[model samples]
Target: MNGLTNVSRRSTQLLRRSLHTSAALRDAAPAGQTLRRTGLYDLHKENGATMVGFAGFDMPLKYEGSTPVESHHHVRKEAGLFDVGHMVQSMFRGPTAAQFLEHLTPSSLATGLKPYQSTLSVLLNPTGGIIDDTVITKHTESSFYVVTNAGRRDVDLPWFEQKLKEWNTTELAKKEGGVEMEVMEDWGLVALQGPKAAAHLQSLTSHDLTTIPFGRSAFISVSSSSSSSAADTHLLHVARGGYTGEDGFEISLPPSTTTLLTQLLLSSSPTVQLAGLAARDSLRLEAGMCLYGNDLDETTSPVEAGLSWVIGKERRSEGAGFVGESEILRQLKEGVERRRVGVVSEGAPARQGAKLVDLKTEEEIGTITSGIPSPTLGKNVAMGYINARTHEGLHRKGSEVGVVVRGKMRKGVVTPMPFVKPNYFRG
Candidate 1:
């Protein structure tokens, strides 16, 4: 405990120095307009986090004593805790809840997923464009727990309200029951990510973490003797997966216990330091995960974004299904003009909006949606769309490409993602 305390104090003390400082990095909240906060906001300040505006919330961009690279590598090596309470958590319940979700997403949620299994799915617009990527956990056939990106709150909530109303007026709703959405507002969410995450969290719960595989969740009771975050016992939702492509859990607990729960997790081990958005972004990018605003949008389809796997093969085989089934089926039948792929560029790391050009023709093929110098690989890795259909073999793996950084073309190669192998524990 002494070591943890010393690390915390030194972290905050150096946070005052603002390593790799940004004008936006400050201790105080951003001015101009009111910003929302998670239940763990107080805990973040106590731990010496440098807060910044993100997804309409005052979130920690990074903590002291560790730069983005340092924190990124820390989570890769050991466990790190993250406050993700700003994400919109919600529940859908009714006799027709499963049917409603299947309509909203392309996943065969109602039929394919067994109880308590979670799938990474995408909400779609009418024309097969991605509305937002989401994780939907089917608690039961008639119930679900969902987590969507906080940045899409404005678009998602309204879409839900409109869709629910429309669905309720249908013959299906009259025959079965109208689905209802219960938004889990102000709920506390934290992700414990790393290869060691499970071992640390295992000490606090009697429920065997070994039985809980990746893409599954369980309601478990947690306790900490040195902490008073919750009562003597607390039942929380522990989803055994995370954004970092590592074995971890995204635990959702009551808002009141947010800070104490975080403290409790920190109390469990010395290495489980608090990480921030800076590390989260780079880690996810390295994991080959999509950022909603950067890699996905209202204009991009799952087929084009290389996320067709998110759509169950069974569903894709049935053409007359889903909201945008027609377009999605058409794309699957006839290929898309472009595909999202990985690129390892030379000279410099590609940035968002960086042009992807053909190696032979130097013609613009696509744009880099996300990129970073991978801490694990020590190489410039990126994800971008490639539209070199006419120049056959250009988008294929091992083919040379170019990522235009500044005005010069940096040689790159079409590579298989994730740049770093995911360490998800299957057993």
Candidate 2:
């Protein structure tokens, strides 16, 4: 069998084994409780999508006919559409909006980011623990757009409200107009990802996609020949960035226009398949992106997660006064006890909760948080944390290690991440 076929078969076996062995890996839908749905819920269902509960919403896990491996390969070779509207979209507006956001994140939003530019940032707690990861886009000096993970809604929303109220009452806000936070309810966010994503999306809009560049966004008008209301084209906020480590765009538009726009994109080319969560997971893993609840949490600090690059140089040099600055700066100077790293192993796939041990001594060092058989690489790839002090000399790439899989120690190695090269479009 070919690699895709072999991986697909192995994936089936792994799923069956996971369901029986791990409760955390089972369906998230609560018994007798209704799960929320996104704007594209019905569309997904009509297209033979298998829905499952994720982050309190019923989302597409995969389609009925194609395997996840096939979907993953399709995205790498061509293009795919994904429904990511479950993420929280919010607007921060006011004269001091940029300053207010800078206080919440370590990124230098006030000085480093120009209008239309975006940065990946983390919201830190008072103790330097990560509250949530977010993407903040600068629309103007007084206006900003931010998208945060849906799983962190309960923790993130209330925190934002409390902080906004406190900041508005401060003396700084009294001099400059106070900041206002507005959640964009029911907005539809879709990600068109793959190597050909730019060409596919460019065919539908008049705005030059090349001008947006990676980490930048623009408001553009989309026209489709399939639409009856061609004259009344819809305005879309298109950001040229995604989690798949591919050249793509995350298009946010009004909820009413979502279905029509999706259909138009699908019709644009046969390669534009609708991918689901299953493919999304593997693609992001290969891209070395961290999933919120899996690789990050309130107890995990950005410095330890190997995400210190997200901290702006200006912020580190001149102190931005962001939340958790003291603890984060201290960690930067002194270093952390444990750090996240990538692991590649042979034999059965190492699922979450698998323990990592010293290759020769068999001493437990850490636990795996995320793992999968990479469809592209056809190898068991995982990410976990290890004691930085204990594995100090052995932390470099190619160091031999062992992962406890099914109660047996399996051979593994410390490897550099982004197992597959990222294809982000810089221009």
Candidate 3:
């Protein structure tokens, strides 16, 4: 749901008309600049969109209706289509690409990933701080498809280049040779997320969509009849992975075919509505997923963020030898200083930056990272961190805690995440 950046009070009114800025401009600005538009920006304008500043792009916050109305539209019948082109998409093609990537993240990419399969990974600093959370998709042994947050575009791209240079200069990869890297900047990506997403996408391709299991992707050609671009289009990658807790796919299409593909998918696909940031935020919160800026930042580590699972069991012992391995591997054996957990508040939503206080000591233990009244769960849910032992002290199994919500303390309980069941497709 990351959209256009630097929206001014004046330009908010211009969203219903047309926009001229491109996505790249949006990424480069932080102030109330004219703002850049995505390929679907005009389509959103035509659909009566109320655009808002998000991430770095001017993206539609909602279209033709209120947020609650759009939220209900998605949860009930079919699906929702999200234009996530503002996200940074890149390709890593080199003989030592896997090894180079392994040097940046802690995940055991060489073992856990298969061709076209993807896994969530964390880029770590030398001290184990999370540089950024990313999705690493394996296209082959020597090539990788990566998608990261737009908010981190400034930090992420330079980090990758610096690391690539250092990796290429390393004795191991240099001695072997045949290793290189490239970043695909002109790609357009869309996410079709919800229960009926698979069915909707299936109508366009003859490939066995079912054969592409969850966490896996495939390359397929999409036939188009629009005048925007070519007749038949090729989707470079389609993965059964998503931000919302639903059976969905993230489609990476060529830049020129973006508008045509979107038009085709929206017009032909039933049970799918164009969704924006508001609903996407609610959906990700309900699914117990973390947002990079709010839930994770450069100050937080994977262990403290409850992402230890991304580290392979063997790597925790033998070590995959990535950046911050010294600290991350140490925490893998011993526990972390703080642990992220889910909290169920009784009254109002305990939003991010809200303090978590111990009922007895009245001490501020941690801060809320993400929270919302889950439309699906019909209650207030929040995720945050607390002193690792404090989490145990407050809620050993069925104990309760207190959270500061709306300037007042409210009763809450420690609970497992995904307050609603995740509907990710395993097959």
Candidate 4:
């Protein structure tokens, strides 16, 4: 449960050290040929999307209209559907699936999870480093659903395969009835996010969305007259979770039914708009969420990234059988040297790698990982790292610290996280 990349906080240091060359450099070298597209690619283009290469896919970074406009369109009055098909989707089926997953992550999945509930988890390398962050949803005792980052697919798949082979040969894994992994490579996934998302989605289903809390999912059918092929044929799986810091759902459907569902969802609620990566970034930032490449990597740990809460108390004591138990436990008790924190600046917004300097001595205390002018808060908000004990010495509510905004230093203050309050539906 402790392995999400602190993209907004931790990745800043890694990215600054690694990708300082070009802003347009795509991470995963070309897939050898043309980039891949989601099921809604043509539909997005028809809507005047400004596509950019991301990971190994050509994705919509923004629309011809602009990003702020698209963001406001979602926050103020309606909803926005984002295509996230680039993510890796898979299903694990076996009598011992739960046990197998428990072996990989530190979560007390056997006790903490209920059927149809999803929890965040980290895949750990043997050396106590994070392989990837993932979401695992328990469908039943014998079946589980997992989603991982698209950029890590090549590395992730081989790791899973090799582990599966080892487990299949072992005695414990044999008792687990032999695991079967299915990679749904071409599946279509869309995130319908915003305050009005539920209202708009309600018109498409008879199911009571109010009963479905955040971090939970259900398989149901959505009917529409404008649907291309069938009326109510597609069996849809919807998870009530999102990165936008709003109450919303991520829907998985058939690729052919993608256009129809998107069109109907957009038209069904005149309030819902098509939001792209631009709005997605700002919204998640305001929410204090991490982007994998930018926020987290193998070099960082949960305690350092400000996510120790994901580690369960029982697991801390009983041991969840994950890879990084010893070092993570040590850090949990002893603490790390640096901790991720949120900062509020007075002058220009601090960009990545902007050194945080002490106003008195002007010595570098830390560096900004992610910073921007928050659309909701109307302040320059940033997430960064500072020396755990010395941080109090450098900046505070009354004291002034310098953030290297451009070439010159600007004034800033230490701030708390979630610039915007998260609207997670616990009910």
Ranking by TM-score: 2, 1, 3, 4
Task: Summing lDDT over every window of 10 consecutive residues in candidate 1, give the lowest-scoring window.
Answer: 18-27
Instruction: Compute the lDDT for candidate 3.
Output: 0.76
lDDT of all the models against the reference? Answer: 0.84, 0.86, 0.76, 0.75
Q: After superposition, how far is residue 209 of candidate 4 from its true place, in Å?
A: 0.7
Of the pair 1 and 2, which is ahead by lDDT?
2
Best TM-score goes to which candidate? 2
In candidate 4, what are the lDDT values of residues 1-427, reduced to their tens digit?
2343332333323222222222222464564767788888998899899787766778886666545433544553467888999889999988778777777777767677899999888877665556778889999987889999887887889988987787778787766587889998778889998888898888888788988999999987678764556655556899999888898999986767778888878887666778777667667777887666666667677777777766767878635676688878888888777777778887767766789888778888888877766666766777777776666544333346778876788888777677788888888
Off by over 4 Å in 1: 1-32, 226-230, 317-319
The C-alpha TM-scores of every prediction are 0.91, 0.95, 0.89, 0.89
lDDT of 3 by residue, 92-132 (tens): 88778888888899887777788888999999999999989
Clashing pairs in 1: none
**Clash count for each candidate, listed in order shown:** 0, 0, 7, 8
Over 4 Å off, model 3? 1-29, 32-34, 66-69, 72-76, 226-230, 233-235, 390-392, 395-397
Worst 10 residues of 3 by lDDT: 13-22
**Which runs of model 4 end up more than 4 angstroms from their true locations?**
1-25, 31-33, 69-73, 226-231, 389-400
Off by over 4 Å in 2: 1-7, 12-33, 226-231, 317-319
lDDT of 2 by residue, 1-427 (tens): 5985775777855643432233222434457766778899989999999887777678887887877777888899999999998899999999999999989999878788999999999999999899999999999999999999877787899999999999999899999899999999988899999999988888887788989999999999888664759665878999999999999999996878888888888888887999988888888888888888778878899998999988888787536689999988889889998888899998988877899999888988888877888878878898888888867855668888899998999999988898889999996
